[model samples]
Target: MSKEMLNALDALEAEKGVSKEIVIEALEAALVSAYKRHYGQAQNVEVEFNQKKGDIHVYSVKEVTEEVMDSQLEVSLKDALLLNPAYEIGDKIRFEVTPKDFGRIAAQTAKQVILQRVREAERNIIYNEFSQYEKDIMQGIVERQDSRYIYVNLGKIEAVLSKQDQMPNEFYQPHDRIKVYVSRVENTSKGPQVFVSRSHPDLLRRLFEQEVPEVYDGTVEIVSIAREAGDRSKVAVRSNDPNVDPVGTCVGPKGSRVQAIVNELKGENMDIVEWDEDPAIFIANSLNPAEAVDVIFDLDNPKACTVVVPDYQLSLAIGKRGQNARLAAKLTGFKIDIKSETDMEEFYAKLEEGAYIDAADEVETLDEAVSESDLTADEYENVAIEAAEDEATAAEEVAEANEATADQTEE
Candidate 1:
């Protein structure tokens, strides 16, 4: 029995990662509970296990009284003195109460206590193991599927890949290994329930971190990422080193690095663009696969922009259903309106024509001049020339006066 108890403690220490002392303490508690169950539940019983001696002892504490009413709690002074010569009235004493039936009860209680303790210890182990992997990418095998979710084995624990967290049109088969992002860990009555996702934007970032050495080493930085998941995604990258190309490094030799990531994503297309400090250039790069002719900023309403692409690439710039253009607007935090070359030319022409007509109407309204009143035909030419020169000199003097006034105002 002593050997079996030592073995249980050793197993608890090794398997459940509990200390030997803790297991021994749990054993003592179980024995005390067993003593109470077999004897009287109200008995003030204590059980002690000496680790070195392999001895187990049970004692019941009773208060000394002149007259004992309840024998379980109080002992008469005369009866206590019979058991112990030092016993005196009003003095508490402990009497041995190791029941013969206690060994059988202890065995049953030990099983229940060990099972409960081991289960709680296992839960703690699972929590600790997965907490370290939070916000990381993990690979798991598809174990089975219910109507609304799929269960995956992540080697240490099972994770749920819910239907909502899955990418559209992506499917998982039994025993298939898939990569997922651990989104959340929940503690429940049963155990730790981990929720994983494949559609999250961070999944892409983490994948790049895994595949791109520059990212891990701090030579290259991923600025932002946006995704539509299973269809297309965009990432903005920048390089700290002048010589090292961030895009080229992420793309790798013959597109090896990016291809690996793409294959893992189940052929989702990726556009790796170089991030720029200038918003105009950044937005232009963000709408790749179609060149941006120009970016027009509307400062009065700061959140709007107009982008022009070539007429033929208009559909491409806007994507099949404006996915590219919409993502660009979101990525740059602007209301993007895409136009083709033809649309831009027509708009500019209308503005120029309006300005020309305004100028013509202004000229038509100006009728009389001081030079016209001072003329004889040949003397008119000379008079007109002199008046023009005089007017130029007067205009120059007025401009000087305005500059002096402006300077004074500034001071």
Candidate 2:
């Protein structure tokens, strides 16, 4: 029995990651409590267990006195003398008060104590394990679902995916393993409470980290992520190293890396674009795949932008249900008013009809000579857009040449 108890402690220390000494100390305390409950609290009890002998010793301490007022707490000096001739009146005596049924009580108490300690140790282990992963990504299986939450088993503990944290129109099934962003790790009376999310922008960031080696190595950096989870996500990337192409590396050889991430996200579309410091250039990149003929910013109203696209590309720019336009608006923090060449011409014609009074002498009026051309206002705006792109290309080329020259000089 003693050997078994020692082995149990060893197992708990190894499995639950609790210290063996802690378990033993808890066992000693529990045994003391059990002895007092079973016998009496006034009796000074001591318990000793030997693994080799499989023996448990329980003794009650008493003070040796001339007269024994309480039999349980004091021993007569005559009786102490019979047990040990050296006994004096003031000497304390430890009488053998070993109870036969103590083995049964100890076994029950030990079981309870070990179980309680194991749970506490496991809770701590789970808390520490998930605490490090907070604000990061994790993968787990869908274990069960409650009224407004889904429980995911992430090896050591279960994480709660609340309804509000889930993407609208997304569903999970039993045994389905999915990627989740660990938003919060909280300690509770029950155990560690892990809040997970699938709709967060960071989920896209983590996916890029996993897919792109350059991102992990600090060669490629994800500047920003805007995600409408389960539908579309836009990521802006920058290259720290001149030799690396951030967008190309994230795309991978033959599009394998990005494809893998898309599969994980269950067919959510991703737009990986180069990050630019200039707001106009960044806004233009953010609205890619839809050719923006012009992106006119309102200086007085910073949140407003006038976007013109070719008549044919108008529907594509707006997307099905205006999703593309809406997403672009959200990403750029702009109230985008999209117009085709025909719509733009009609709008300017109305403006020309109204006599315009110049608020500032510096403000340039639309040249009637250029406006006479059937090409429309959008065509004129397209010229300005091209000029901006040309300047940006020239700047990038110069920067790259400088970096190349520096590298050559170093070599």
RMSD of each: 8.7, 13.5
What's the TM-score of each model vs. the native? 0.78, 0.66
How high is the CA lDDT of each candidate model? Answer: 0.83, 0.80
Q: What does candidate 1's lDDT look like per residue over 44-131, in tens digits?
A: 7778876765567788889999998898889898888898889888787877877776667766776787788888888888988898
Off by over 4 Å in 1: 63-71, 74-92, 300-303, 344-411
Error at 391, model 1, angstroms: 22
Each model's number of backbone clashes? Answer: 0, 0
Error of 2 at 361 (Å): 18
Q: Estimate the TM-score for candidate 2.
A: 0.66
